[model samples]
Target: MERSYPRDPEWEAMPDVGLEVWPHSPPDTAAYGEARAQALQAPEVEKPFSENLANEALDIPRSQERALSYRVSALMASLARLNHCDDEPTQADMRLIQEQRMLVAMQLAGSPSLQQRLTNPAWVADCWSDALASLGAIGVRVENLPEDCPWDQDALLDGPQPNGRNR
Candidate 1:
């Protein structure tokens, strides 16, 4: 007699959604990281010392907003091209772009509202869904996938919060 491991027949063959490959959460993190990277890259406003560093604290955030906007523009273009390609991007390739998309959406949210962030965090679930839905129509689902992404949250928050709070 041969020994066999018992398992749910429906679920036994389901693909593993490891932490790295989880579609939703990881991509969100990556995009925020990249957005932050962009913000930090922002050059100090060319000043003759008259600007007086005009709030270096807030200036840096503006830099980030600019960076995220630029990156998201590029990503949107790339996504459009992917959609029009002679051969649709593979699931793997689509997922990679979807991660970038999630980042942009997160950036769009800007900083967490004073009443937001770790508490009753509604930003991630809804806007993320909207962005992913648009991408999904093109065949790439940004569901629970792993994150191998680069986002820049610090920069994105520099502009304004999506809910119109963090100006």
Candidate 2:
């Protein structure tokens, strides 16, 4: 059966981006959402109390061990999948991803959280900002950057991306 998105009729939106004190409107006007969800569950059977307690009680360490086991198992499964794959990312693809990381890092570095650390030479070098700068050079202009991007996000305002975003 095709799944349908259940409706919420009263989700009114606000025009501005600032913080909100309270929900302007509640979404569930009729309160039928919970009713619909509960109707989908099977009715409880007349099972024994011991059987019910056994199912309800969990071995916490065993549960945690199972989670950790699955996590490592997933990592192993991913490694196997990568091993079986015929095509792998090329140098150019890796370079493109690295460029995007640099762009995103540049965005992150200029955020208010990093304001105090931005101008520090150590912060710049730690992110390999200069090495990436001299490597590829994407030439986007200052005004054309992302809306929230800093004026001089990385390197200089005048220089190109490592490959030449400026030129």
The model with the greatest TM-score is 1
| Candidate 1: 10-residue stretch with minimal lDDT | 158-167
- Alpha-carbon RMSD of each model: 20.2, 19.2
Q: Which tens-of-lDDT digit does each residue in 9-67 have in candidate 2? A: 55445455432522343232112222223333325633464344434332322343333
Residue runs of model 2 more than 4 Å from their true location after superposition: 4-98, 129-158, 161-167
> After best superposition, candidate 1 residue 163: deviation in angstroms?
31
- Backbone clashes, each candidate: 28, 11
lDDT by residue (tens digit), candidate 1, 5-110: 8888899778777644334333234344444444444576355342443344345445555555455544543443354345546676556566666675566455
**Each prediction's whole-model lDDT (CA):** 0.44, 0.34
